[model samples]
Target: MTTLPQISLAKLAATATRREERQRLQMACEEFGFFYLVEHGIPKEQITQAIEASRRFFALPQSIKERYGHAAQGMYPTIARGYSRLRGEILHPDAGPDPKEVFDLGIDSEGDRRPFAGSTRFPDDALAPGFARSLLALQTTVLDGVVPQLGTALADLIGMEEGWFPRHFSPPTLGQRVIRYPARGGTCAKHTDGGFFTLLLQEELPTRSLQVWFRERWMPVPSLPDSLVVNLGDMLQALSDDRFKSTPHQVAHSGESDRISLPFFIYPDIDACLTSCQGRHAFRVAEMMLRNFESVEAGNGAGRARELQ
Candidate 1:
């Protein structure tokens, strides 16, 4: 009967002494690896608008949605950065084909640039007005405010100087994905996020889908309105020498209706090197992504093989 903890960013921001906030965040990162974050400064209306826009996009004809696919018009085929149809590819093949559709976008360059930085594909304004704007606004909020605050707190927790973690992100590599999960048995299989961390904005639609690995069992994370789920990622675990757990989690069928969520995967600069207790391994962001794709391909093949047996 383990439960998730909710922490407020406002308290972490305004308080003179951050000892308690740092300790709490560190504990959550070490123990649960996931928590509910409130007062994150993103307007609730903007979140609602983003969710509604996702729903509208999903409701469109499959042909129309396919126009934004990776092979469609203007999308980067090197990475997972475009519209993917339901069961199009298995990210986690252990649970079989994923019963979900996703639209992925990477960092929209603003002056500072990186290899994978670019604008996102979007439908015409007549079809989906304000969709791109709302999504980008929310992403900007996380990049400008929330992520750096967490990074600062993390530096404090790790006994580093105030700006250590934030300074590493001179130009971050980010990807935002809007997902739609249909009412099926399994939506997404268990897996760890493949970045520094994630800011998940999920709809509070009376669904019990998201579960985290805790106490050697899967524990449910309740959906609360106007809040975001902040979770650690594999890179953080490696950077901290496994001091902070990047726990595995999965999404199941809501069974009531389609579920939509927005997850902003935040990463450090592509060329930044990470140091851990093990040693200093130069982990490039693009290389890590390539490994993930390779794993997915292997897993998908293994899944098909097991199905034959």
Candidate 2:
């Protein structure tokens, strides 16, 4: 069985050792475009609590969960920062809406009326106690560390200047989705992520559900103990001018019980203009992200697979 390469986030994030680890990280990004991130240093209890809270949220009555549904509150179709009900989001056009339910939260902002920017719609504490806090705490900690450090490392891999990526990401448009894939329904069809990169903590199952297209075959990615799976996204692929790949992946769950996975998507600020890592022409972050958001929601996929061709 093929397993994803394990990259030590501790070493990759360390300033002294990052230079040494960059070659390995780059190889993983280019060859597999994904890896298992070990020694990320997030507390075990925090990961447990976040996953438990997410499970509890999904167990809630549909009516209660819909109280914070994102579609109604979002200023634009692209804003999906709240609870997204099952079968409401379409990631792969052929598979239709995924049978998974998701609750998303991003960096809190006040009065930013643009798409993908605004205060998160948090559920009432009474409705789902600790649901908000646990998830937010996990997301916050990851953002504070990997969102910057890992991002910088990726930039360096593509020859981006030191500290240049952070400038555009000052107040990044990042978000984490706590997803629940129930027992009965269609599988999560093949699709590439639409952002810059993703940090995922998935439940280890007897049957592998998460897979990546590699060497002309779909390979299952095992869930390792205390490790988060990291993958590049299309935006980063474009930024790297395909020097890095945004590998296509999917979930085909055959398990009877519900599964919960936490995936954090990292991207630059909405208003930031991003170009190729080689300093080519640029496009506004908001436009591309919103377009991606709309397409993914509408089951059009990220539509960035064309970049590879």
Per-residue lDDT tens digits for candidate 2, residues 253-296, read 77788888899988888888778856653678878878888777
Q: What tens-digit string does per-residue lDDT give for candidate 1 at 26-88?
A: 888888889989878888887888899888888889998888887753533334567888886
The top-ranked prediction according to lDDT is 2
Tell me each candidate's TM-score. 0.89, 0.93
Clashing pairs in 2: none
Worst ten-residue run, lDDT, model 2?
300-309
lDDT of 2: 0.80
Candidate 2 stretches greater than 4 Å from native: 184-186, 279-281, 303-309
